[model samples]
Target: MQPADGINLHSPPPKLKFEKLSAYKKRKLSHSTVNDTSPPTYQISSRAEESDNSSVVEPDKNLMAEYVDFVKVKPTKKEEVLRILNKKDVTSPKFFQLDSITREDMSHWGLNPGIIAQLRDNIKKFEKHLTPQ
Candidate 1:
């Protein structure tokens, strides 16, 4: 009979079985998988003949520098504070102080003002928990 939800409940649940792979099958699977550590090979055609060649493309230095600059200026006070608080040995008061200092540093490090405001709000929330009982 169908339930109130109008769904069939008479069917049995599916059964799951786990099996071990044979050594030969495992070796075959490993051979089929591509190794990511090595650079990929490509077919390059010169004149009328095509040859398989592996080439490593190096990233432009200017592009890498731009990425590094972006990362350096990103606001990370919240993560830093949480990391400090997660340590088991640190006391609540010390954690709060460290969080405040880190927050100030992040503000001065060219982080967006909105992010600093959010970090300040987070600090207030954590302050409530860290206060003496």
Candidate 2:
């Protein structure tokens, strides 16, 4: 509703414009090094060098492709693989998922330190044999 003076009380006040401050001269050199010929010790160059080969090296695509199937397999699928490994009879050669199998699982499966060491040695030997010459 309008006031007795005919002024709209609901209307907001008009916006005010402000003038910006004058720009100042930027300092090219520090007060201490104004006449010095030596380069500034603390100053870092913004320019990138063409010879700067420093970068994050990505994994080789072909090498990564070799293990892509292993990476894609789910945790449940990996456990199923462990279960299949567990089901193998004592007479058959057994394989363990070293990454997935914990110390508790090894102890539960009746593996001692000597057997674990043998298993690691065997794995290394197998890796050496399977790797390309």
Candidate 3:
């Protein structure tokens, strides 16, 4: 094709893009077969647990202070006591102690507030169970 009358307006062709596939993908394409060997499961060693291996030294106070600071238990109080009671479904007359000492769900949670902590622990266990071995 002839160039423009007073300007060279020809543009180069666009570059082609080629993405590389991983080795796992290539193997999948060659064969669709899979081995039958199962994965491992985590198990606590009862023998070790029973042993009297208490040689490890106790942690120093400075180290303990650092750890405590790292895991500081700081909970900002925001929600009212009634809101918390409403969430845990603890509306029964038996739940309230002296009637005036109601606690907030925000500061803590359900009943002794420790139930919320247990709830968090149970959730962690559930997540561990869900993981692939």
| lDDT per model vs. reference | 0.41, 0.39, 0.37
Query: Residues 1-133, candidate 3, lDDT per residue (tens digit)?
Result: 5644544435433443556889998787445434434332233344322223332334332432222222232333223333454565543222232223344532455334543333222423333443598
Error of 2 at 53 (Å): 27
Q: What's model 2's lDDT at 104?
A: 58
Worst 10 residues of 3 by lDDT: 64-73
lDDT of 2 by residue, 12-130 (tens): 43443444544432244454467787655542243211212223334333322223222343444444434433453221111232334554565566555444444433433443544
**Model 3, stretches more than 4 Å misplaced?**
1-19, 26-113, 124-133
Q: Count the backbone clashes (under 3 Å) in each candidate.
A: 0, 0, 0
Clashing pairs in 2: none
Over 1-133, each residue of candidate 1 has an lDDT whose tens digit, in order, gives 3444433456543443446999998887677665554554444444112212323223343432232232342444545533433333222222222423465565555545565454434433443544588
TM-score of each: 0.20, 0.26, 0.19
Once fitted onto the true fold, the runs of candidate 1 whose alpha carbons sit more than 4 angstroms away are: 1-107, 131-133
Q: How far is each candidate from the true structure, as Cα RMSD in Å? A: 21.6, 21.8, 22.3
- Number of the top TM-score candidate: 2
lDDT of 2 at 41: 56
